[model samples]
Target chain A: MEELIQQLKEQIIEVLNLEDVTPADIDNDAPLFGEGLGLDSIDALELIVMMEKEYGIKLKNPAEGKEIFKSINVMAQYVNEHRTK
Target chain B: MTHLGKIVITPRGVELNSQVYPTSQIGDALLTACYRSCHADYPKFFKMDPLCRLGFIASELLLQSQDEERFIPREDRAVVLASCNGCLHTDRHYASTIHAGDNYFPSPAVFVYTLPNIVTGEIAIRNKYLGESSMYIVEDGLTEEELVQRLAELTFQDPVTTSAIIGWVDYHDGDHYNAILYLIQK
Candidate 1:
């Protein structure tokens, strides 16, 4: 889980073009949107694409994104369980 | 309309109201250097394409010359930008992404900036501007003075707009990009 979370952080930073951010900057449980990382709607879409491209986890429902992308910890846990690749 | 201030950015250097920023480094680093010179804190600036970067930096410097904060929200202001190339640079980048093969993922970040007018949108979002704004791909070989006149006419056409950051923001590559913005107010 720790390894996956760190990997997710790096991937998110690269995918979102968050140039100044590092894996250490993002807290494991901090919110990815609104208050924590301040990611907007476009960023959310990019994250979705990143998940599919990297993890082979096709998010069938759009609503599931909110739960899956809550944070690096939640995202890593979800991907670990559901990712086919 | 009355001219409040003006900013000129080019490969040579950046000039705001005759105050020249030293040409420390040119090309890709120039825009970042300009942003850093202002000591401004807008993280989204890094994500913008070169065209948007030129416009954003020009507008920021233009506003600063008038002793105004670039991020202040206002409804009476507008942005009228004209570009010669009109995002061909980014179009080439977006095209590279959709190539049919094992790699066919088009980046939404780069896709959002495919239009020339997206610069206005980015500027609007940054400043919370709820006023008239537009982007034009100018066909005429107008001189700098002529462009100022053309932009002034566009801004004046929108009666609701009391002021505007109007100019040409052209960027094709690291070697070729220029933005000259004038803050004009009624």
Candidate 2:
């Protein structure tokens, strides 16, 4: 779980091109949107694509993103459970 | 058109009303470095394309003085941006993302900035400007006076326009980005 969380942080940073942020900078429990990372709607869409491209987790409903991308930990768990590649 | 303030940004650095702000990061880091030097707090700058980033930084620097005026949701304020390349770099990159049939992954973050006028939108969003906003793609030899003239025509044509932000912001390549912005008032 810890490894997955850390890997998720790195992947998010790389995919989102958060140039100033590092894996260590992102808290496991911090929200990925609105507060914490303060990402916007576009970032949510990017994350949706990242989930499908990187983990094979195709999100058909855009509303589910709020919960799935709530935090690094949540995303890590989701990826671990759903990733096909 | 009464010019309120002018800001020029190049790979060399920035010049606001003839005041120089030199930067050490000349090539890829010029825009980010300029953004930092201006103490701009907008984090979305990191997500913007080269064209939008160049224009966003210039607008921030150009209107930094009008701190109070910029924050207010002014309906009479306008933004006009000109570029030679006009988001060409981003369009090429975005095109590449979807070009392949097998590996097509066109992200909205990248695709949203595939237009030159998005710079005008970014400036409007940041400054809460509800007035006229537009962009123009011109030849390489478009003069500074001519850029201002284009904006002046709009300012006069619109009855509600009391102030405007105008500039030529272009990013042709990593080493050839430039933004010349002006804040104008009647």
Candidate 3:
């Protein structure tokens, strides 16, 4: 679980092109959108695409992402449960 | 048709307001070097595709020394830009990612920049210019005459537009790029 979270942190930074942010800076339980990382709608779409491409996890409904991508911890847990690859 | 400011960024160096900037460390990568030289803390610049970055830097240079609020408000200024390639560089990059069926990983980050107007959007987002922003794809190349004609058409199109940032920003391949942006007061 810890390794998945760390990997998720690295992937988030790389995929989003967060040049100034380090993996250590992202708290696992902090929200990924709004106040925490301040990522917008575009970032959310990118995260959705990343989940499918990286983990072979297809999120059929976009609304489900609101809870699934609430935070790094939630995302890691969801990916761990549903990831095909 | 009064010119407020002009910035020309070429493979050689950058020329801002008719004065050639120091091109010491700006060897071949002129746009990247110029962006670095500006010392602006816009991290979103790094995420933009090369064409958007070119337009972004050019617009920044044109607006750097001006009192932007005096002549144009957020909704009064329009960005009318032209480009030859029109996101071809990013299109090719995105294609490479998806073409290899077995190894296909289509990146949304790269895919989002597949439109030419995204450059205008980037500038608008950066400067908070909520006015009309448009990009034209000039396949052959954009001549000065065509640019002027386009600018005239854009200015007269809307009564609300009083000022505009007009330019030809083209990026081909990775390193081949050129931009000539002008701030014009209508």
Candidate 4:
């Protein structure tokens, strides 16, 4: 779970391009959006696609994943339950 | 009098950039290169209409400051973009995507970028600039002075057009693009 979270952090940093941020700076349980990481709606969509391509989780509606993706802990829990692969 | 300002040129795609993305495509490369050069994040841009991406980048460079609000005024600012292709690359991409499969005809993604003035719209939104805006199409390159003269004449009707964004955005199928922006001040 820890490794997965770290990998996810790297992916997030790369995909969303938080240029000034690094993996170590991200807290595993910290929120990824607003206040926590300052991500926005567009970042959310990118994350949705990233989740589908990398984790085999297809989010029918990006909005539904908002709560699940609030933090790495929540995202991992949701992914563990729903990943197709 | 010649409008005074700085000219910033950006070239997209290495091959095309050699001639600097000349209006003609002389080399072969993936279409993605065109989108990639202007943005570090491809998927984010791929999801957006190409015009939006072009506008965002161009505006970022044209405005080029955090305190742009002072330069871009509600009444004085105007936007003018000149392009030969005028979204032709995006149109071609969309046609191929739809032609390949009938089930999906309209690619909202590509379709939205298929406008000549989208760059202008994007500039307006990013800067919150509510001013006279227009797009011009030219068959061949015109000197910067000529472009400024043309734009000034067009915006002459507006009294407060002291500063403006004028540029040329042209892209081709071989993933080549050339965008030049100049901020004109009277």
Candidate 5:
């Protein structure tokens, strides 16, 4: 679980091009959108694509992302269970 | 028949308002070096594709010394830009993502910049200009006569358009780009 979370942090930073942000700066339980990461709609779409590319997890519905991508911890948990590759 | 400002950026270096900028500190990546030389603080610039970045930087240099309120109204200024390659480099990069059979992964970040007109949108958004904005993909770079003809047509077509930012910005492969922008007033 800890390893997955750390990996998620690194992937997020790379995909989003968060040039100045470090993996340690992202709190596991903090929100990934709105106030926490200040990410916009485009960033959300990027995250969705990242999910499919990195993990073999295909989110059938965009609505499912709202729950799964709420935080780093949530995303890590979801990927661990659903990833086929 | 008035000229406000002019800027020309090439792989060699940058020329702002007819004077060549010193290239002592500028290294291989001329675009990034020029952006840093301008001392622009806009973070969104980092996320833009090379074509958009070139257009944005050219527009910024042209409008930097002018008073927007007194000279050109936000709603009356038009952005008329032309490009040759028209985001071909970004398209190639995005295509690479889905090329492999087992590693098929399309990137949304790169896909968003596939359109040629997005560079015009970036300029409009940055300057808060609500006026006309258009991009033309020409086979070769537009000649001065062709650019003037287009500008004349735009000015005549839109009664509200009294000022325009006209230029040619082209980016190909990697590290090969050129942008020449002119601010003209009727």
Candidate 6:
């Protein structure tokens, strides 16, 4: 779980093009959007792709991501539980 | 016509020779490069608000070092942005994730950057420009006559339209972008 979270952090930085952020800088339980990471709607979409590519979870309705992506804790939990691979 | 001066920012570098910049990476490369060539230090004028792409470059050219006090509230400052794709680059990139996989839900982060006028908003925030602002996405390139007429109307009718930045920001691909800003005065 710890390794996966770390990988997710790295991926987020790369895909979102976060200029000054690094993987170690991201807190595992910190909010991924708004005040925590200062990410907007676009970063969320890129994260969606990261989920599919890294963990093999598919989300049919993009809207469903609201709750799932509330925080890295929620995303890691969801990925752990529903990952097909 | 409120012909001010033409400030062209292309991806390849400074376009002092009136050369057409290749239309690629219209989002970051073209916009940032244009702004960089016009200004010595790119960081001085760069704002990472995501919406600060085209208008940011054009406005940087017009304001130059006046950005510190640019928001002093001029009576005649208007923001006029015309782009073919608007913020579609961010939109399409976001959509690709949702469409690519079934469980991949759409992200709110990616969704907000889709608006065509976000660039205009960013410009307003950076410059504290409380004057008139607008965006137009035409099927083809905007007709010169139409653009000229609009400029005329803004300068004549609107009291807060002293200078304007009118141009096209079309990002059809990752490596293509084009912007031409005209800083007009009454």
User: TM-score of every model?
Assistant: 0.92, 0.93, 0.87, 0.64, 0.88, 0.65
- lDDT value, residue A18 of candidate 3: 86
For candidate 5, the per-residue lDDT at B66 reads 70
Q: For residues B96-165, what per-residue lDDT tens digits would candidate 3 score against the true structure?
A: 9899888877877898899999999988877877789988887655577678567667664888887888
How many clashes does the backbone of model 6 have? Answer: 27
Colliding pairs, model 2: none
Q: Over 4 Å off in model 3, which ranges? A: B22-33, B36-39, B67-73, B139-146
Can you write out model 2's per-residue Cα lDDT over A2-67, one digit (the tens) per residue? 988877788888777787788889988888887877788888899999898888899999999999
- By lDDT, the candidates rank as 2, 1, 3, 5, 6, 4
User: What would the per-residue lDDT of candidate 4 be over residues B1-186, giving only the tens digit for each residue?
Assistant: 234344333333222212343222222322334444434332344344444555555455445443546444476777887877777777787788567452333434355567778778767655666777787778766886677677677765677676777666666533456666666675
| Candidate 4 displacement at residue B94 in angstroms | 8.1
Interface RMSD per candidate (angstroms)? 1.1, 1.1, 1.5, 7.5, 1.2, 5.3
Q: In candidate 5, which residue pairs get closer than 3 Å at backbone N, Cα or C atoms, i.e. clash? A: none
Best by TM-score: 2
User: What TM-score does the A-chain of candidate 5 achieve?
Assistant: 0.94
* Model 1 C-alpha lDDT per residue in residues A1-85, reported as the tens digit of each score: 8888888898999888787789999998899998867788888878887888898887777678999899888899899999988
lDDT of 6: 0.64
**Candidate 4, fnat value?**
0.00
lDDT of each: 0.84, 0.86, 0.83, 0.63, 0.81, 0.64
lDDT for position A4 in model 2: 81
Error of 3 at B150 (Å): 4.7
Model 5 TM-score relative to the real fold: 0.88
**Residues A1-85, candidate 5, lDDT per residue (tens digit)?**
9998999999988888775579999999999987766777778888888888788778878788889989999999899899876
Q: Is candidate 2 or candidate 3 better by DockQ?
A: 2
Query: B27-111 in candidate 6: lDDT tens per residue?
Result: 4566655654654343423324334455576666656645466767654677776767677777776777578565465655556
Better of 1 and 2 by DockQ: 2
The DockQ-based CAPRI class assigned to model 5 is medium
